[model samples]
Target: MKLEDLRGRLMAVDKKFKEMYEGLERNKIKSIIYDKMGKPVSLKKLSGYEIENITEKRGIVGVDGSINSYGGIYPHYISLIQSMAKSTLPKEEDIILQDVYVPLFEDEDGQAEDELKRRARMSKLELQAASFAMESFSSKVIFMDGSLMHYGIDCPSEWKKFKEKAISTGKIIIGITEEVKTKDIAEILKTELNLNDSILYDREVLFGILNEGEMLEFRRDLKSKKSESGIKSCYVRLSEDPQVAGLDFIEEQYVEALKYADLIYTLTPEKGRGIPLWLDIVDKEVKVTDEMVKSLVESTISREIREMLLNPKRSKRG
Candidate 1:
């Protein structure tokens, strides 16, 4: 198809998109959200949750994980998982951990085994780091990289351990997704708005939907549907950017979770992506760079091992 043809094909759905947006507006989607199970809240701290109290007494801890693989194919590749949990408090030190997994001995019969193994390993490592952070730091709040539901789904046992630890310790743990991937609100609104044929993710449905400094929450039924056991989620537009973010909370601690919204929003920049600036710092620190991985492999694994077990055929092509 020509460029004009491509443009025309894309434009074919414009009417539907526009009508959907109009329908949401006509129905007062924000109020509908209130009735459904969530309360939209402004980015203001509740009493005793002021900036000084947040930054000093109840410092926010950011936990994030990174994974990198060297080599090709299932059996030949080695995956490295690194997670970091760092407190926003200047006095507290960073908690960093690493795990490496190679599928040399593990039998990979299915195509998905490699992917599953890597993700599970990474999730487990992240949760482990988070649990460690809870014990090491006096800070009561932790902001994890992804949704709480993802941790449970990806690594249930580790999630259970981490959840129990946070609960017993009287600490708060929240998951922040830089890019919202949930579809619960979209599905519910699609039904409510009488758009049965529509298909939309939360990302598309919520684009520019939330007002600046506002968050979208929903009812208990939708919360249970969208989350795994013990987890709940909401969407927040913390910055001037139209893009929104997902914030997941522990079910019982959701009240406490909402109270921290102001603190998080305070850390987010108007000119930046919706994520808090501190979490972005943790992300950069936690990432396992290519140079680091290369140095690690070369220093630890000998030449024969590298040739036989580590290097993929693609490495030699050039």
Candidate 2:
């Protein structure tokens, strides 16, 4: 393409973007706010006294995991590790409960492949860890790094069991996700208000509406077979960070959920990353670096097996 043509195309896109930006700015005048339960709600900026210097008797647990795979071997293998922290102790001294599993696949089915196997294994490990945390640390809040909803379709029974156990034990389970793609709010606006903006995501819309220390709770529909047992979710902004995160918890524990959110805000650093500090600590502890994987394989497997497992195409280059 000629340079002139390229410049002309770029200018056309820029003009279109400016027009859309103006449209969004005008649309905000008629924007509607709704809670998780689809009821109309008003947004209030939380006061300093409401969130500052808050104290509670409940303990907090943060859970996160890592997964790595080696693909060239006969039985493709993945190393899965989950780390849970009961307290905000230093990373070195923290009594983090860890569960590690290496699943080897010998079948031709894709279910045994790295991605699917990793999701399944992580889901099982997280459920077990949440249960253990609740039973072991009574009345404490259990924080999982992602949605309580199981990602794989094959694990509905396990997922339902976890939710039932959590409800029966009266344990508070909070799932914090850094990124979200749910279109619940957008859909509500389009269907109910007759407003449509396909380009904006839930987070992007909420990002402009919510102030720091405020959250918008929405009731999710549980009638869907894949819903996470009627869990309620909220979009929260803990700090001055422009990004908003999704927080999911059981509907029965609404007050406790807000308390957990305040606690998370307190732990969040002013100038640090948007996530709670405790979550960052647990994530660092659980992350499986490439060097760690290499060390583990070298220390455990024989050199003959390692050489044989190395991808032949890569081996030939040497």
Model 2 vs. true fold: TM: 0.75
Candidate 2 local lDDT, residue 110: 57
Q: TM-scores of all models?
A: 0.86, 0.75
Cα-based lDDT for every prediction? 0.80, 0.61
What tens-digit string does per-residue lDDT give for candidate 2 at 80-101?
4555545532332333444444
Q: Candidate 1, residues 23-141: lDDT per residue as tens digits? A: 55633665556677577777753345567676557577899999887777778877778999998778888888999988886776565876787788888888888888888888888
Q: Which stretches of candidate 2 lie over 4 Å from their true place?
A: 1-23, 26-30, 34-58, 71-77, 89-106, 111-114, 151-154, 190-200, 219-228, 310-312, 315-318
Off by over 4 Å in 1: 1-37, 45-49, 55-58, 221-223
Model 1, backbone clash pairs (residues 3+ apart or across chains), number? 5
Residue 121: error of model 1 in Å? Answer: 1.1
